[model samples]
Target: MTRKAAEPSRRQPGPRRDKEPLHCIAACGREVDIGTCVIRWDQPGSLVCPNPRGRSACTRHDPRLNDAPTLPFSRYRIHNPDQAYEELKKTVHQFVLHYDVCWTSRHCHQLLADSPFKGSHFYLDLDGTVYQTCDLYWKTNTAPADDGLGNERAVHVEMANLSWQARAEESGLHLLQTDAYRKTDAGWLLNLPAGRRQELRLQSFQPLAARAYGDRGYFSRKINGRTVRMWDFTEAQYAALIRLCRGVHELLPRVRLQVPWDPEQRRTPLDRLPGFSRFEGILGHAHVQGGNKNKGIKRKYDPGSAFDWGRLRRALSR
Candidate 1:
């Protein structure tokens, strides 16, 4: 983004009105109540003073009126992305990761730019393309329901895709057969033999992180009387997630690191989560609200069961 320097204003001050109070609309931090002043509004919606021919001279002179300071385009850094991470160190406390469960990155970007969800700091596509949306210093209005955990104090990241099979393909990984079965009216639908299912149960199931940011509902859906839960994420996406998290941590040294699948802290109340404090480190949206039966509210379960916490922890540690 291009940067422009502030310039001097050439407009003269308006004539002083002794009986009337004078006020400046340029936000130049000048007060005009006690005595006569030259401040006046020349036109509607215009910040500069008109400076009428016979009016009193303006007591305040600001150079910025001539040329306002220019911020980077969209107040964001896309080329040197690490600079953006460095810029966020001061104000950001939490780093939240979300999956844009859409089919493609284009759809994800369009959806996020719309109302309510328009505040994410970065977007990482399946191909590892990172797009900086808002300025690092700007606070987005994401996650308002979480009180102190909203866009004001946190940086949000979005990854795109849907389901484990798709995620594995995108990441060049293979999905192993499992005995897990979905119970439907037609009877039990098994992905593998019952004996194999038991063996697979001992292992973790990894799915791609595919789900819209706004979809915070139950992961399971009833299809033809069958309960089906889908989840996924690509290896490239996971690697990008690790890099992103590490970059954020390095920039903001005080931020604590956290993953959603904390076995010891299972079923922890939302209010009691780590986000209540500014010192709390990085955490997942799932950590804030996971599962359909979370306390009283039916919270979201995105970055759902398929996300591999073990891998994420190992990667961050490295």
Candidate 2:
């Protein structure tokens, strides 16, 4: 039996195991077979690995692995973060460029040429109070205060607002409001015929400018530098738009609608409306009424704000 000292058996350096999906264990430096690993230890020290009960290593080598499986996202995850970031960055850069450098409405037009979102949000708060209202509107109507043009264009806008809200509904945009306002003692006063509370309806997206008074429309928003023609209906169009907005609202419930905050004022009547949560964003029209001391109105866009290069991206992608 001693003839030719029996050759010694070679030992493997790492953990011994059959071929399997490779996963670095948290405790051992040695690679253990996936089908065999049974022990759980924190850092890879000489802790016991259960599979063979012999495998062991230190924490330095193998880190914990995330076991979560991959799954598809739902429509609620509609806004692509990566893509939205790109758009936000581009719009922000352009805004910086034209912010003070290009001091004209036309300058703003060129600045927002690549905006991802249609409009910028503006907040209006009454003085001496927390009350605020926010509205999201595309930057149209950027002409120099209409040059005191005929009819001042407010009545035309009023008609347009009524029509546009109806159209937006038909086109599948559901505006939502919050019920929190109803529970307040000030809620009953909201029953007024012409208070801001009445404007709370998602339908009243636009409102008459202070100077224009009772003439402007809710949806008659301004854009870069021109009167962007809304989906003005011929009665037939308005009816169709109503149905569409309701349908779209039903389909995409996440696109919530709500009142904008008015930090300066202590009270906000718009908060009392129903279904305010459906609105996704806001429209800034504080300047539309001539209160913008900075004259931001000069920087607005036209009705066809979509004609700009920025919106073209979305339209083209679709």
Candidate 3:
């Protein structure tokens, strides 16, 4: 899906009409107050989704011939913001998270823009800035899940993390000759290119893993029948993500600020869930897209082994 940028408003970027333009998550073309900073699609410093997909089947909210998943904003029609928001909240219930396998959110945005039809509603940066690329009313073809209906009911965030690709041995995609993170005195820190360092939203920030596994500074575990290893998210990322979760919960009441948990296993299962679509709340893309035992679809491992599910769960509990 390809998304045309939002039509430029005659008014300048500052102080958009109706929206407070600060610390909010957008829905139905308007901003709803959220916990952290969110750069909206219409704002000047926004990473607008290159291709925004419109689901034609959902006529309750929009019925303007919006079957095209790659329709430009101008082609899509929204009759009423009040009605569309209510319908959108009723229809959407899941908040799917992803590791973008990029060095930074800016880098992730560039890759998304280069892609033919790939897009996400939000992008969580290493420095803790959340970029809202498109309104939650639109669907991004980020994950089809197993039933191929995950995108239909969920909003998605592409957080910047290299995943297994950080290690040269495990990184087949990028062909990295060395590990992305350097063993600094402070612990493990993602080493970005000199030029790219200046691109971060937080100029003084250093992307360091909030926690380390053993002495390796990364964690390895079996997820989706495969060994997935990655460094923990930065303290800032986890903090920002928690706020984002709360913010999502605020905007879409059905999307609770909680992760998946198994009472029998006594741990959060890091694999494709059996009743994925039915389970509502915050979840990883891996939880939705990790194909079955028979292997009809390719397995997915992301928001990988290193993510702190327990911390997220504990925070959401409060």
Q: Best candidate, TM-score-wise? A: 3
Candidate 1 lDDT trough over 10 residues, lowest sum: 48-57
The model with the greater lDDT, 2 or 3, is: 3
Best by lDDT: 3
Error of 2 at 8 (Å): 72
TM-score of each predicted structure versus truth: 0.48, 0.17, 0.88
Cα lDDT over the full model 1 = 0.42
Give the whole-model CA lDDT for all candidates, comma-separated.
Answer: 0.42, 0.20, 0.80
Residue-level lDDT of model 2, residues 1-318, one tens digit each, is 011112211223666465532222211112212121112222221121111100011111111210112111111121233332223222210010001111112222233333322111111111100100110001111122312211111110101121121233332332313211111221111111234333232223322211211222222334333333232112321222222222212222222222234457632222111222122322112112222345443333222111122221222223
Better of 2 and 3 by TM-score: 3
Candidate 3 local Cα displacement, residue 84, angstroms:
0.9
Alpha-carbon RMSD to native, per candidate? 20.2, 27.1, 5.8
| Cα distance off (Å), candidate 3, residue 121 | 0.3
Off by over 4 Å in 3: 1-21, 60-69, 292-297
Off by over 4 Å in 2: 1-232, 257-318
Order by TM-score, highest first: 3, 1, 2
List the pairs of residues colliding in candidate 3.
1-117, 2-51, 3-50, 3-51, 3-52, 53-69
Query: Which sequence of candidate numbers ranks them by lDDT, best first?
Result: 3, 1, 2
